[model samples]
Target: MIEARQLTKRYGDKTAVDGVDFTVRPGAVTGFLGPNGAGKSTTMRMIIGLDAPTAGTVTVNGRRYAEHSAPLHEVGALLEARSIHPGRSAFDHLMVLAHTHGIGRARVTEVIEMTGLQAVARKRAGAFSLGMGQRLGIAAALLGDPQTIMLDEPVNGLDPEGVLWIRTLLTGLAAEGRTVFVSSHLMSEMALVADHLIVVGRGRVLADTTVQELVLQAGGDTVDVTTDDPAGLRRVLTGPGVEISGRPGSEQLSVTGLPARAIGLAAARHGIALFELTARTVSLEEAFMELTKDSVEYHAANTLVGAA
Candidate 1:
């Protein structure tokens, strides 16, 4: 597991990361989410000892990364910026890293095969495509078979096949009780993989919760009800936190703050006939936008990138 306590970073007079605290547990995938310039990259750097924390501390597997005798075996990280020699072949790159920790050539070959780099293991890294390069980076991360794995924007240039492969690989790692912390802009994909989330904004931790809870907190769950007597059902269901709104001249009622079952029960009590009742939910992307709207450092004039 990875733990951060009041972690902070400063570069001269500017502060990149505030006093942020969060824990990434084992046996599940924990998603790290933030907008641009939210200090996410800085925080990740501190976790792996790429940068010294200005204050507080971060530890992987119950100890600081530097304190571990075999640091690679304790945690493996793949950041956005690639750390690779362009002239070397994928196989040579992994082999060189393996040699650092006394890892054997067999382990290097295993990661190469695991990352689907077997076909191009002998090819020079400079000649590899973006997706192929990403595969090589992932190969290095898995080289140690570490207990903790952290990745930032891992699917940046991956094709659909590579994307699916990563999804399966992460889940399999978590299934083995390993700590899997992934940061991605693909909310649709993270919704499917992450069991928990740590959302940050403005160099501060905004929320630490599950995917389901985050969605619910974004205006609760919505429901759709198409009834023959919209007015009658509306009269019975509309109360306190319940809301009923629909397009003009439409019989369907768009509901909020109430479960479909509860609405059905209320309608039944009022002897209202319903043709359809369906529960609608907010997506993870929608929730993220709602939670971080005020914390965004930059705004695009021509795009709704956060919402869409």
Candidate 2:
């Protein structure tokens, strides 16, 4: 498990991370989300002891990362995939890390196969493609078989196959009761893999909730119904906290603050014939935009300057 209590970081006069607190428990994939310049990298650095926190504390399994006797066995991290020596082969790189912690050659070989790096295991790191480098970094992370795994943009350089592979790997690891904390800008990918989320904005914690709950909070279920009596049905379904909207003079209505079942029941009781009734939940990307709209550091104009 990973826990942060009022964790903070500052450089010179700027505060990169404010007092943030959250717990990443085992057995689930917890996604870390934030816009650019939102202190996500700083916070992850602090967790792994790459950067010292100005205040508060972060711990892995009840101890700071540096305090662990076998740090690799406790936490596997992939902060920077290219932070490897260019002259060394993938096999040699894994061997070096394994040797540092008394891990045997068999484990190194195992990780190479596990990461699908066996074909290029003997190639120098500098000659590897971006995707292959990412695979090597992931191999190093899994070499220790740590209880906690932390990765920043693990899918950044991956192809579709590699992306799918990592997704399956992360979920599989979580199923085995390991703590998996990954930061990603891919909302669709996170929606598929993450069970929980920690969304930050401008150096502060903006949200800490389950993925489905956050989606519902940002935009409740929307129901679309095409009925013959649009006016009468609108009046019948209208209630406190309910919202109903439709195109001008159209028979279809969009509704919020109620479920489709309730709408169907109401329509039947009122003799409104419904041709279509569908419920839609907001996408994760939509929810992220809604929740972090004010926190985005940069905004692009919607219209193109040269467009007619």
Candidate 3:
């Protein structure tokens, strides 16, 4: 497990990570989410001892990363794939990391096969495609056979097949009772992989909850109803705590705060001609946009002008 207690960091006049507390439990994939410049990268760097925190503390397996006797075996991370030397071959890079910890060639070969890097093991990393570089980076992270894994933007440059492979790999790792913490801005991808989420903005923690809980907290359910007389349907739904709006390109009414069955029953009671009635649950992307809309630091020119 990984824990942070009142963790904080600052650079001169700007604070990168505010005082925050959270726990990353084992046997599940926890997603870290936030907008750009929201302190996620800074927090991960502090957890791995790459940056010193100005206040508070973080620990992995009950000890600071610097205090671990075998740090690589305890926590394996892929903060940024491009951190490796560009001129080195994939095999040589992993070998150098192994030499530092006295790990053997067998373990290196195992990770190469695990990440599907056998075909390009001898290619210079600088010449490899972005997707191949991501694979090599993952291989390095798994080289130590660590119990805790943390990756920042692991799927930034992956193809569809590579993306599917990562999803399966992360699920398998968590099933083995290991701690998996990954950060990404892709809400759809995170929804498919993560069991829980940690949302942050403006150097502060906004939320720490399960995926289901986050969705519930965002808002009520959405129900889409299609009828021959949308106007009549809207009139019937015009009541307290219920909202009706027109759906694009169809004779459908978007209803909120009402169940699909209730809408259907209302139409049936009125003898209205109905074509369809279905519940439209909001996507994870929509929920995330609502959660972090106000916390975003930088906005596009049009948005900024509108806000002003």
TM-score of each: 0.89, 0.91, 0.87
Q: What is the lDDT of candidate 1?
A: 0.91
lDDT of 1 by residue, 1-308 (tens): 99999999999988899999999999999999999999999999999999999999999989999999999898989995357888898999888899899999989988888999889999889888889988888888889999999999888789999999999999999999999999998999999999999999999999999999999888668999999888888789878987789976788989998999999999998889999999978999999999999999999898666785
Off by over 4 Å in 3: 225-258, 270-278, 303-308
Name every residue pair that clashes in candidate 2. none
Model 2 lDDT tens row, 114-134: 999989999999999999999
Off by over 4 Å in 2: 226-231, 238-252, 273-278, 301-308
Count clashes in each candidate, considering only residues at least 3 apart in sequence or on different chains. 0, 0, 0
- Global lDDT of each candidate: 0.91, 0.95, 0.91
Q: For residues 125-175, could you state the per-residue lDDT of candidate 3 as single tens digits?
A: 999888898999899889899999999999978999999999999999999
Clashing pairs in 3: none
For candidate 3, what is the lDDT? 0.91
Residue 143 of model 1 has an lDDT of: 91
* TM-score-better candidate, 1 vs 3: 1
